[model samples]
Target: MRKRATAKEVADAAGVSKWTVIRAFTPGASITEESKRRVLEAAAVLNYTPNLLARSLATNLTHQVAVFVDDFANPQKLPFLETLTERLQAEGLVAVLININNHFDHVHALLNADQRQVDAVILFGTAFRNETLSDRQLGRGMPPMFVLARDSQIDGVPAVVCDAELALRDIVDHLYERGYRRPGFMTGAPALSTALRRRQHFIDFWKGKGVDEIAILSADRYSAEAGAGSVRHYLNDIDPAARVDVLMCENDILALGAMDEIRGNFGLRIPDDIAVVGFDNYELGGASCYGLTTYEQPRIEMVQAVIGMIKGRLEPETVTLPGKLVVRTST
Candidate 1:
């Protein structure tokens, strides 16, 4: 291994105190401009990389924020991350992405925070209302935590939430006002916050109309194929006498997939036999094949709002963003 240069060597080369070299690396540390320039010059000449851990102990700040996201595989999360990173960069803070599959992984960040590897932590996509996030281990922290999801307020962490119920209600009311009934739902899991809100919206709407039952299906993946497969399952399982008049997919992919399966396999006409509605009206939903009726929540606005919450230094609180529904040919 190559011999590593030390801070003492840089201090000798720059003709300054060892503490002077440390202050240059620490954010908001008081140091003369001339001294900082000398340290930078000495560091360049000696090819020295500052020991971030030691500096973190000196300042009690790592200046690096850890971001916990469900998984990058979900396309919807990518944009949110990109926007958040841009904002974090603008604030002169590093955003480190940590994939959250294990519940106890968040605790690791706290350990890192103490060591000055990561400062604050931001959690994305997954809600904290469930047991995994509500647990004391996951909630306690050395670094402040912020959740980016709908219906947040997980234990100790403040939430950057969305108005999912209002969004769903608006979409449902729009369809109902347009003289549509017998709406069905497609969702994969009951535990997810977004899925629960959408699924319950259909129930409350129909129950208010004196309807006894509403057709529903569970999806495995948030993809077009999953949507298509879910519709197939519903078709095979539902009673022929009380088929769904409309399908309200929890996401755009499902709405588009169900529409394709309905058109290609079952040979049913859309908006005639059944109208379809979906959320997150992504590019696929807007495609000519789907032209899906869906709710377009302030996607970019939501991203900005969460980033804003994260950017706020020490003054942490909950933030709620608005959403809107759009009518298309599918309805």
Candidate 2:
């Protein structure tokens, strides 16, 4: 194999010092236009490219972020990750995606990104523990860390999340206005902090309204199939007269699944027999077939907030955005 060209070779070919070659390649370094042009010409001739890893070592910034995610089956995670990567790319940053299944995996991913000199780390899933993030036993010198979509507080870590408690209040109010007295919640897993909070919020909101009876069911996963299976099981045992008037799914995908089961398998009319609602107003939720009544989770706002935290525009504290309701044919 041919030996790779070095900055020294480019400098020699350009008739300039190696310092001039380095400055010319640097984004905002002080260099004369003529020298930069000559350096560019020499680099082109030699097919020389700056070593980003070496540059990061010298500057102490990689312009690379590590994103830790889980639950590949969740329909919303892909879109959320895509939006995050695109926004980071727009700001001249690169994203390295790491799929972690549990808290131990999260720790490993963090350590690995730190070793690789990542500028920041973002947790895009629900399995990480807030306490584990700040444990002193972990190695020192971690990059700026954040959690998205879920609210968690570590001393130096911030989370950009929608206000789920407040959002559930809006959902409860809407359900009440629509004459839904008996409501139920369908969640993927109760182990997740986000899911637990959302579940409790629904129960507390309904109890506060003097509605003592409510049903809550947890699916094995967040997939549409799981949603359909859980709903099917939920309806089998309940008496027809005591059935839940409204079923509030934890997310749009789950709601979509439940809606399909109710219409397709159970042969029930939406909004007439059972009004269905969901959160995270996914794109398909607004389609003509579903027209789901769901909460609008501010993805753009959360992404921008994460970027601000990465750039030090915002402090390391949780930022909660309000939720908006989109009423459609579902409710």
Candidate 3:
């Protein structure tokens, strides 16, 4: 087996101190261009790289951010994760993804992240509850935490979320303009149905406009199958006259399923018999087959805001950014 070159060897080759080599590798560390060039040339020749573990030990910062995610079934999560990870990498940080499931919850993930000595933690799952943030077992030495893509009401914890109020207002105005008097909302699992305030905001926005008796349907999960099943059940339970003119879904995946169920199973014509709308603006929503009219969350902006909070450029408070409504044939 071949021996790996060390930093000391690189320093000797570069004719500089080991500390100079360290500064050359460290981002934002004070080092002259000539010194950095010498260190890099030596490192390339010797195939030497700084040990991240040793660097973290010396700096007390891993440059790693733990991102907790659940709801892997939802396609929207994929784009958000891609955007977040790319952004984190661009900022000279690494993202440690942690999956939160029934077997392992947010509390468990928190402890695990803390044990890893991550620089920060970002909660990206909708399944997490506010009470979990207040859990006594989390302890005081836990790393700084932020909530992404969802509203967090826990005090002192910053959340980078879409402005639901503005989104609801835009949706309601568009629906009313399109003559959608009776509105219905399709929500995800019971755990998330209450956790996300979009459902309540949808109802409130409609009620404020004097549109009473908004119908609500709950899906078993965030999958398209659950969405299709929820629509199937709702359509079968209610008479045609009592049906809503437009159906709004919590997310794009649910909306896709609902459309499939409405068209494939029931043979209903979209925008004529009923209209469907969704949030998150998943890429599939723009397809010609579905042409789903959904709300486009400012995903990039929201991610930048989270990074800003992490970098101390922005305050760790609830930051809400506005999203635009996408008009398509479905609506």
Candidate 4:
């Protein structure tokens, strides 16, 4: 086996004291530029890289974050994962992903995070209960957490989310101005809190505007197949006489599915007979064929907010960013 090169050996080769060599490797340590240069050159020649684990023990900071996400199949989540990991890498923080699909899985992931000594945790969904992450449950030295795209408040857990109510208001305003009175919502599974929040906000916003009645249909999941089925049910079973003038979907994928069904199955013209709108302005929304009118979440801004909390630059509190309404041909 090859002998490992130590800081002492680097110091001897660089003609500097061991203290100077340690200072040269430490961030923000007071060391002369000449000494640092010599120390780095000797380290390179000796093939000696500082052991991050040993340094973490000394500084009490691993600079590693554990990210937990459930909806890996969701297209929108793919971009979110990419952007988050890239940003963490740019900031010199290591990111470890824990793909959990349920509450029990989240608890296990939390335990794994603690075992790995991660500096922070970022959760991507709202499925995990707040109490499961409390200090009493997690013990005294639990990592600070940031929940992304979750609207509900989890005690002591900060969240970075988009304004669901604001997005719904924007859609309603656009549809109303375009002479759409009988508006309906096509959303995800009944068990999903995100779907419930979006549906309730739309209903409340319209009700507050003195609109007495609004229709809502639930899909089995947030997928194209479920969206198409919901639209079929809404048109055939719920509003068989084609009473709805506009359909607002909870996600872009849902909207696309509804659009396909409307044109292919129902033979209804889009934005002519009935307009369609969606949220999460996924990249496919910009395609000429779809051109879906929707609200775009400020994902970059939300990520920055979460990073700020991790770095102690921002308070650990829920931050809701306003979504931008992208008007397209679909509406």
TM-score of each: 0.79, 0.92, 0.95, 0.91
**Model 4 misplaced stretches (Cα beyond 4 Å):** 1-4, 102-104, 134-137, 189-196
Q: Residue-wise lDDT of candidate 3 within 1-331, one digit each (tens)? A: 9898888999999999999999999889999999999999999999998999789888898989999888788878999999999999999889999988889888889988998999899988776777886799987899988989887766667888899989988998999999999899998866541156888899999999999899999997888999999999999999999999999999999999999999999999998999999999999989999999999999999999998888778888878899999999998
Q: Positional deviation of 234 in candidate 4, in angstroms?
A: 2.7
* Models, CA RMSD each: 3.7, 2.2, 1.7, 2.3
What lDDT score is found at residue 37 in candidate 4?
Answer: 99
- What lDDT score goes with residue 29 in model 2? 96
lDDT of 4 by residue, 1-331 (tens): 9988998999999999988988998889999999999999999999998778877888788989998866655677888888898888888788898887645476678888988899999987536665555535578687887888776556677678898888888878887788878888886644332222788888887887778678777777677888888888777875556568889998888888899998899999998888889888899988999989999999899888898899888988888899799999998
- Which ranges in model 1 have alpha carbons more than 4 Å from their true place? 1-5, 25-28, 47-49, 69-73, 100-117, 125-142, 192-196, 205-213, 239-241, 299-315
Write one digit per residue (lDDT tens) for candidate 2, span 129-238.
66667566566678888889886645666788999889999999989988899999998754443233787899999999999899887787778898999999988978
- Whose TM-score is greatest here? 3
Mind giving the per-residue lDDT tens digits that candidate 1 earns over 146-230? 7775555455566666677787778778877878767788984333532236688667866777765777688876667888998
Return whichever of 1 and 4 wins on lDDT: 4
Residue 274's lDDT in candidate 4: 80
Clashing pairs in 2: none
lDDT of 2 at 91: 85
Per-residue error (Å), model 4, residue 22 = 3.2
Between candidates 1 and 2, the one scoring higher on TM-score is 2
lDDT of 4: 0.82
